[model samples]
Target: MRTIALHTQTSEQIGLVLENNDVIEYVSTRPEVRTLSGSIYLGKVSHINKAIQAAFIDIGEERTGFLKKESVPWAQTSIEGTLKEGQSITVQVTKEPSGTKGAQLSADITVPGFFVIYQPYGKRTAVSKRVDAEQAEELKTWTSQQLGKDEGVIVRTAASKVSTQTILNEINQLRDLWTRHIKANTTDRSHKLFDDPILPDQLIRKHPLPLIKEIVVNNSKLGQWIKQRYPILAEKVKWVKSVSTYTGISINELQSKLIQPVVVTEQGMELVIERTEAMTVIDINSHKFKQKSLSSYQKLEMNKAAAAEVAKQIQLRNISGIIFVDFISMQEKKQEKDLQKYMSGLVRKDPVSTTILGITRLGLMEITRHRRFSNVSEELSAKQKPTFSKDTLIYRLERYLTENTQSEAVLVAISSDLYNHKKQLLSNSISSKIPQELFVRHDASIIDWQIELEGSLDMIQTVISERVYHVDNLF
Candidate 1:
């Protein structure tokens, strides 16, 4: 059975996890403002670097969005002074901000709908490759007849099973939205004209609702919104408490284990995933599996199992960009070829575009995945070793208490030495937020920056120290 769990209890942002039977297949979270993709902006060109043939556009955000000259539809023509520093243009964010680099933008924007994607300036109509060849040709013919010469549409896989009226209805809605955006862009004020929905709504629009066996949302407000907005899915809507018992691993277990770098399989094979500034490296080790007396076939089977887990972890962690995987070496060329093919097929299932570069001379597999947003591991790593000031700590403590309304009083356990250092800051915040009762359970075993909160912190709390130690040793 297919199950989707919407986790909003962690913070204000929402997270979605797709599971098949009892195993996690996909995981994603709503991005913050700095990393927002698919947002349409009316931006002013800031600087043009002729050497690189790229321009930086000021989208009224913290960082400028980078627009390549080739990506600009008008830049291809012989129009002099077409893109000036002060010129305003409509662009969509194709990539999120990574490190110090800005967001990637494209002038050719396409608005995606449930059944089709409307390309305002596109030349020809097309169908999704997932559709069969016979139906795809028919869809192309139908699109040519139905659409105007100036219009273009890309029929989605969902359109193959949907009615013509449904496709037309979606096309009309998208056209109206585009028209409104164009009208708004003509005004003097520059702003964000459009943005894709949050994680939950995006999933609903991207996938057929009928295919999902159940939708469980942890936040009551989000669940109510889903029920009211899409009454057709109301029957499948369930509260967080009602569905907590269904997951193979409890939410807390998933959160705790997510921060770890190593995954041990049933046969004791280990897959170590490490993310660095330049690239991600995955190492497969069979030290424990070798203890058992097994033939070469059994070793290959273990390697295949490790390959599947690596693919799952890549998607689960949202690791993007260059990836190098070192698998257990096989002496036979036929076995090596089979392992390479198996790994390629597993990665093809990723939602983000991924390219497998095949096995290198050293037997390492190279891969490249389009970065969408900061992966779950990256997000957690950012907060793992943060240095907070007095005011920041107070603010965070207040925010945490306010967000978790279910907890009347929280027992905070921390190192005595660290507690003494921030005693004033903690007391001040506790006095304001927790008027009823405040308990401080100090233990020397707790390290600096380590915090333990008991009662109703299932989603917000993360065992950072435990995972950090494992990562430190692994690296």
Candidate 2:
């Protein structure tokens, strides 16, 4: 279940609902915050960089509007041909600017809300894929009859169960707003016609708090705004007098907890997930599990549970791209199949879609997920706590070697700045166990070492043969 909560001021007070995840609640009375999602903009082009195939437009903010060549209108090919310095252009803000990047803009405009996307220049009305074919035809017929010649609405996923009048009303409202904007900007080439609403207004419009369980707010102005816009949310709002009260702890105490270790446990095993620029890597440790005491079936079951948990964590953290899961090897084919089935089931619960490629012979699972925004680590981590970590580097190397193996066995270990820590440890642990005559190589560029053994060309073939997986673990 997904629930959304809205908080006012600076303190994060959003709560997640346990039953249905789609609903979010926030406290804000500002009308600007309520409907800023589909607002269009008439901006002034500040600069164009033909070399980078990008342009920066002034949108009346601290940051500028970003327009890439690919985002330009289909009729416009080259930035040099389409745009000029100080020229005014109509652009739609796709995403808010963060960090060094400016707000993302597109020449193609789309006005999106809960139920529909209104395209000013579109020629067709389309239904959402989630809508059933029969229902879609009925809605289409109704919409066409009501809209007549107006053919710019694209029904969204939220329109599946909505009333026709509600969709039409929203479209008309958006169209009226756009008309006013165009009229206001027609003669004014030097001024910015549209600017994103302030943060408070944006929060109200884009973040729906009704679906959320609770909201915490620190700023009195914002709290009042919430009460004015959404009286229903007022009861659920909690006011935080100060930042300290908002965090539920003193600054010093919270700082102390930042450096504390995070311990995760499951089925007598422990694991840790570390962040990196390329991808997040999770390390599995048997920990207290006595060797040979647990059957292969039991061990595989435990690993499947662990994998499911990790998948949930990834979704919670909004991690994306390549994810590699290392599981304890099970020689039995049924055990491997069961583990794969369980893991896939767990992953299906995620709101975002994921693809689970089955385990390799080396006991590694390859997974990929779509990313709509930055992951949690990227959003929250500071400069001092850079995204890279020793654990992540080792796991990535292990995953890479396992997937990219050729004719040789690859052994990898991390390198240390002081006295060869990971290198010495890996060499000591596996050097005597494997063939001594194998080719060895040390990569000091990053934190890991790479060791390739001879006569393993057949290994890659075997690993590829065992692929059988799908994402259904969450069920």
Candidate 3:
């Protein structure tokens, strides 16, 4: 059985897709720059380069957005002298900001609905390839008859069973929203006019409702929101006070498993995955079950098993960009072809667009997946790494103390390694600046870059109560 469990923390929300009690997919959204992909922004042209035909747009963010000539909505013949510095333009983010570069923006805007994507600038109707050629032609003809000369619609696969009126209504709603955004963009400069829906709403719009057996939420407010947003799934909605009550595992346990660098398959094979800035590499290792004698058939079976497991891991971890999979060497050409076909079949289950490039001469399989947000490894590295500099640690400590000024006394505990590294601070007179009976202790139990606070029992209880609440009323 497949189930989706939701848990929200601070400004972040997490969703886990479980199949047969095992997590197959994970998603996390936070109020941070990493989650700003696909948003429509009204930007001011900062600079232009005629050599590359690209312009820098200031979208009211810390970094500017990059717009290329090919992504402009204007006619190719009429684009000359159309854009200039100090001009306001409406652009949508096609790729997220990476490294020091700004986001990739496009002038052509497309709004997605439940059954179709509304394109105000487009002139032709398009249908999804998932539908049969005959049915797609029929859909195209129907869309062409219904849409105006300035409007176009791309039929989604979800519209296969939907009524004509319903599809038209959805398209109309999307067109209205797009028009509003465009109008707002023209009036406001360097501001966001429209953004994608929240996580649950996005999931509902993408997946078929019948496939989601249950929608479980840890908070009553969130559960109510889902029920109100998707009335058709009201009967399947569930409210749990804690995520642990719904899923056998807690959020911490699931997160720990997701960060593991090595995964072992049921066939006694192991996969070690490494991620770098340029690409992700997966190495297949069979040393665990290796014996004195091994046949070609046995090796082929192990490789095939690894193929399926790799696909599942890729989806669960949300790894994107160029991926290189190093498989066990096979002597026969037919075996390599067979393995590639099997891997392709497995990757078809992923929702993201993934293209499997043929194997290389060195037996490394190449793949590319489109990415919209930071993957699990990137998030974990930012949140869990313990390498704070001494100055940063002191700044954080001072900030924490300043925030809790009402406390009568405060105790700061840190790992021994950090204490030893900063022992000179004791003589530098920085420790004496702390006021209100502050105590700094070195504890081996704590991590190097982490700071622990101890307050009254009453304060701890209040924090816990505020975190976990009863959602029984949601049902």
The digit string of per-residue lDDT tens for model 3 on 388-415 reads: 6776775676567656656554556666
Writing each residue's lDDT as its tens digit, candidate 1 over 261-334 gives 99897767788888778999999988875566877787678889988888888887778999999988777778
TM-scores for all candidates: the values are 0.70, 0.58, 0.73
Report, for all candidates in order, the number of backbone clashes: 0, 33, 0
Off by over 4 Å in 2: 1-3, 11-40, 46-56, 60-86, 95-104, 133-151, 176-268, 290-292, 332-345, 357-361, 378-475
Which of 2 and 3 is ahead in TM-score? 3
lDDT of 1: 0.70
Better of 1 and 2 by TM-score: 1
Off by over 4 Å in 1: 9-12, 21-33, 45-56, 74-76, 79-88, 98-102, 181-186, 201-211, 218-250, 291-293, 382-475
Q: Per-model C-alpha lDDT, please?
A: 0.70, 0.57, 0.75
- In TM-score terms, which candidate is top? 3
